[model samples]
Target chain A: MSAPIIGLVDYGAGNAASVRRLISKLGYRSRLVNKHEDFEFVTVLFVPGVGAFPSAMEALTKMNLVKPILDFANSGKPVVGVCLGMQLLADSSEEMGLTKGLGLIPGEVKALSSMEWHIGWNTLDCVGECSIASKSDGQNFYYNHSYEFQAPKEYIVGVVEAENPIVSIVRKHNIFGMQFHPEISQISGFKLMRRLLEEFTDA
Target chain B: MLKKRLTGAVTIRNGMVVQSFGYNRYLPIGKPKVVIENLDRWGIDEIFIQVIDRSAKSLEPDIELIDEIATSGILTPIMYAGGIQNEAQAAQVIRAGAERVCIDTLLHINPDEVEKIAKRLGGQAIVGSLPVGIDNNGIIYWYNYQTKEKRLLNDRLLSLVKDGLISEILLIDWQNEGFDEAFDFRILELFEKYNLPLILFGGLTSEKTLKKAFDAPMVVAAAIGNRLNYSEHAVQTLKNQLTSAPIRTAYYHDRSIFKHYD
Candidate 1:
């Protein structure tokens, strides 16, 4: 009956504090860890980000969190990457260059060339089969990034069909990723996060 | 693919939501907690809360309210702006649970302060909340509400960019305050060359205005307020009407499943 420990990996980008606060609001205990050692008792691993892909990966590497994150993803312990953290989950990004990612999913993070940084409250165009996100029913979630995930339809659970469509939700086993930041997206974000937390505990 | 951005703005006067016409005419809305909770309900992207009265004279961050929002399970990133004139204040606010700090009047008073804060919290964490107004002559100017004075907007914007002060700029058109005339793209014409991430606020009455605003590359976002509160199905109406995909979608993956972030 101990409180679930949500491991929030802070790789020096913004967005961690908000994620931490959101989890706290959900009546759960969360900690921001830059090392894998902190994952000992962690039930869920949340990676929050707010910058470029290469820089995020670089920070994770510098902090030596890359392997721990990769291992967590492989462990099926329910890991989620938000915003740039989501981008970092892909295999590579064409942003600054063809930089490598965590490769959790078979995809690439490409720049939003046709459009500017689509920064706004847009609907989560739910598409594929997802336990939590698929029920969104055109719910508008918050977003703030300029890169798009190229995850194939099989891996994508939803699409945030805004000015430009992008993979809004991706899942592989227990690993989950969100291109839009639910932590900062308000009640919709909070509700979704809570649902994921419930799923984590239920599973 | 096209991307879009969502910005939910909450005006604070003494730590509570206040309504102001354009950039002036303050009207008490309610507690910041309630408004934030409501915004959270709507699934807003990012929340921008600006303090109308805080300045160099006032250093308090309505810490109690901010603390409340930080812990209230409102997971959205709250961008706090007010009385931030130094790096200490900026750092304090962020550490107190603000994801970003929007700067204005003071940032111009001591441009270095913006640089100092941005350096500590990364340029992305610092945003220029410029309150702009245009005269009959069509000259854009930055309005100083405290002194009731006006200065050329281009110069201020140039100075901020040249000095590496802010990574993004939130433009609030004083002239467009409550009229809902749609965002004036002409105001954005001058900054097209600069190409910094710009968010347009004020006069966003209809989704039609938003569609037009989204056409510009530099105009990354447009925030809606009163109209949302007045509408019945505001969330769905706007979502259905705002056909253009925002910039945030491009990089976001699973925007569906709710997350837990304590």
Candidate 2:
């Protein structure tokens, strides 16, 4: 199968260069989606974020790329959100204050009830049978976040298995949101990403 | 459970990797890319790139070097230290590809700005770097290189840690850094009541010393400088020697993918 063009969202929040470089290293081509017009030739959307929530949403709003991105997700193309980007996929967040998000995924972002910070590496517990479940169960991924996605059980693909079982992976149709960083997750992350690329190609 | 982290703390001097001693002497190692590449290949938990010359020499964060490494497809998270004073500089460092920014001089110069930086770019992105020394009398003091003040930790630092302005505190032993087995775990005793997540760096090379540090519940990571660069697969070999059940031991070797990409 020909490689799908990864539309790396570059709104000055996440390090788009690193994600783009990772895509290239995966033998896939990527183009920065700073403006709405850049989404025309894109096959998949990779939303990467690491900063606060309100500022990230503000950058997306300022760039005027929110509606186009929603339109792309509504088109049934594969979309991946890493770390804070996954939180942005929710309906609202309470990072700095109550702020609205992209709303592609049916959920809300909340702070971890277990700990104030969840840094370093942790294994993901597969929930129901899904594309990521079969490939990434019991596998470790690097996670650096304070908040987690609070979604329903049906949409939850994987979780951290903490006292509260914080959501780590969420999926609904073609849109997927991962709270862990797959780009810098080394080999384990590569396996999940390869499966994601394959799923996108088959779609 | 979250696994403990082992970070490859590299001391870079003028775009080249160097071995730092006592924060005054520097022995050149090699290029930054080569050092980071090997560490990433060895599956180091995190990479702490401390450009010692940036803050002292009045230079900006090394964006070009960071861009080079990020473009090379490094999988480890990088904590960049050097000349990060304001929110703009911290944002620039993160945008350039570092997972977190370490502020040394700023924490001593103006600590109020650290809160702003943490607010702008989440507290997770900010790492409060503290270079401390314990005197013979057991007095814990911070080494303020800018004004040559060995001030007490109570001077706004302890407050910041208690308030959780930064995600983690990189407790660096500037006096004993690069000297193997010289790190004093006694300083950790002082912070026992605070319940702060600390990354212990400096003079932590030998297996015995590392094991002693991992015993501490608050020490999140062991940042080994100078010594890891001496041997091949140092991180893996070191972790292998210090293997305990709770410690993080797995690291992936994706040489084939990198080789194929090239």
Candidate 3:
């Protein structure tokens, strides 16, 4: 049997390397797919980000990866969006103006409009069923962002707060998104990533 | 009511995690993954993986070990240091799963390298690791391990800060390792003039010292490699003590939020 290949979208964001490191740490080979051609070999797709939403989305689209990425997500393969990447899944973002996203999840990315960057370590409030987030609440995950998903209640699988309420994790069947950096969050982060790998790969 | 954060340290040697202090006194700590996982389980906020081995000869970061720690499922952020002489290595460490990179010898070798890494990776990810030595006359000198040179600590710190090369500074007391003495607060007083976050290391023996350091406005966090490794349940006990404070009530409630994500 061959090891599952996880594709991390490299849209020139700062965290692609960290995400790749996390994926490699999980005993899997992760490729940094910045070009659209690499999409064919990806068993699972991970769109990871750590900076501004509009710029990230623009860069992804500019790289001409939006269609192939959305196609991959719709193909029923496990697709994940982390932090800024999660914010990129929403239909629209009020981050800079009214920037568009992949619209894979029913929501919008808005400035924490109310909360500060919610930096440092905080626990997750897992609410619904998820292959990665299930049975894992009260687990601290690192968050460093000034924006979050205004995701619908139905898709919100987890949450973390600081100064104001914000969504921490979300999903829609095979599609998943996390507002925290599980890579840096330590064990909890690793557990979530591992669960995702197992669920997606069924290993 | 502000609640402070818990910090942990991992000393790496020759790409392997080693326990050492007081200058050249080394002990094998096995794997960095196990050490990091142990600290992560204890609920540390941030971890510092100091690469003492990288400083021995050529400055090359141990990227593989850093990647290993990232994959181990530890829940703390890691700050990797040692052998980071330039921007490429610093970026590699960040790409290898280090949340921050600390530069010591490079601050003296190529001051521009420090600023370059900070500018690219963000200042928060770049830290200055200064080894302070108290000579026979009680005069403190900053030792550059790469160049094997010692200069007055203040001058070195001022020069680094002036160049915008360092946003955070880790002050290590080289002579007091395992001596059970407290950090040299008098030496750190000089850092107060600069607007940098000072992290004190070397002789952090007890919670009392931690409390003292916490009270100081200049000190953001304290590093205790010897005391933590020596004391049983020291990590858990300290965290329990910290989380037990009234200030952490709301933060504890925040932990409840993990349920939604689970």
Candidate 4:
């Protein structure tokens, strides 16, 4: 099998460049998923998310990327969303008075109940078997956001406890979401990205 | 559980990295990229860069610097602080690959704009930085280098914390920044009431100060600049010494990660 073609979806914001740089370090080349045509040759999709949810949704809408992303995920090709990117895959978010999301993985992004803003690094507790479960369980990943992805039980790949168990990773078929940033999570971030992307390639 | 952070800071002036002493005296370090690369390799949990002279010169944020670091393939979470006076500039900085943007001037001059920036980028992406010091009479006041103003924590600055406009307060001890055992603990007393996580910086290089500061429940991270730049794997070396601290174990600097830079 050939290597997976990675494409970073650029929705005006998000850390697409940083994620692309990480992909480079892992010996994989990626492109900016700007137009619909840009998604053609790519086999893997990465939504490098940051900032507020409303503006993020608006950027995706203005770029007309919501449908393309949905179609890509529906096609059974691996699509990964990090931080705000992960929240975007949900049905909606309560970030700025209830904004609608792409609804790909079925969930809502709500304000964290335990704390106003969960910053710093936190360890992820693996929830059943998923990508990197054997290796990534109890590994610390960088987190910087106020909202948490409230997905269904089956989709949860890992979680971090606060006053609540915040969903850190979610996987439903070929779609995956990480509430924490793997691109900048240091050695663990590198290993998590490499191990999972390698698995995606092997699959 | 969220582990406390050991941030590696880059102090830049004239578009070059430098070691700063009490916000005035400077020792030339090197290029900004080289310093950032070292911090990333050394496993610093978070990296924040400050171009000290930008706001003083009425300049904008160093986007070129941010872009350069972003594209350099840094694996550590990065933040940019300096000359970011408004919402658009903060957003621009984030767009340039900084996960968060630290604001010092804006938090003092126009707090309403901070609320707007928070509305746009959300609170987690904004860090309010106040360079503070205690006077000879044991009075802690926020200091402004541009106007040489030292006032008690004013209503505007307090409102930023009260309104939750910033995620954390980067309380910098400007007077004792590079000096050992000089950062006055009274400086923290002014902010302890706000119930916000604090990232202590300036002259907080010693293990005694870091440990004491970290012992406080609200103190989340201590950003060290001069001390961490002294040697190779300084980040690891420093963290290893604070063995009892809640900081993550430092990752060895592996060169093979960058070898296949595609």
- Identify the candidate with maximal DockQ: 2
Which pairs in model 2 have colliding backbones?
none
TM-score of predicted model 2?
Answer: 0.96
Q: How do all the candidates rank in terms of lDDT, highest first?
A: 4, 2, 1, 3
**Cα lDDT tens digits for candidate 2, B146-253:** 677898876477677666678889998888898879997888887687788999998988888888888998988889878778789888888888887356685547
Fnat of every candidate, listed in order: 0.40, 0.68, 0.26, 0.80
Model 1, residue B238: distance off in Å is 10
Model 2 CA lDDT for position A106 = 90
DockQ of candidate 4 against the true complex: 0.70
State the lDDT at B197 in candidate 4. 86
Q: Which ten-residue region of model 4 chain A has the weakest summed lDDT?
A: A127-136
Model 3, position A182: C-alpha lDDT score: 81
**Which tens-of-lDDT digit does each residue in B6-111 have in candidate 4?**
9888999998888888988999999999999999888898998999889999999999999998888887888888998888998899888899988888766788
Residue-level lDDT of model 4, residues A37-130, one tens digit each, is 8888888899987888999999899999988998988888888898999999999999878999988899999989888789989998998698
Cα lDDT, all candidates: 0.73, 0.84, 0.72, 0.85
> Distance (Å) between predicted and true CA of A44, model 1?
1.7
Off by over 4 Å in 4: A1-3, B260-262
lDDT of each residue in A84-196, candidate 3, tens digit only = 78888899988658999999999988766563335556668877777679767877777766677898799999876555667899899988998888877655776778788
Off by over 4 Å in 2: A1-3, B252-254
Poorest 10 consecutive residues of model 2 chain B by lDDT?
B245-254
lDDT of 1 by residue, A1-203 (tens): 77789988976656677778777777788888777689787899988877567777778888899898888777778888888788788899987678999999889888665554455566777777777886675766766666788888788888766445677889887888998877666556766887899998667
lDDT of model 1 at position B121: 62
Q: Give the per-residue Cα lDDT of candidate 3 at B229.
A: 62
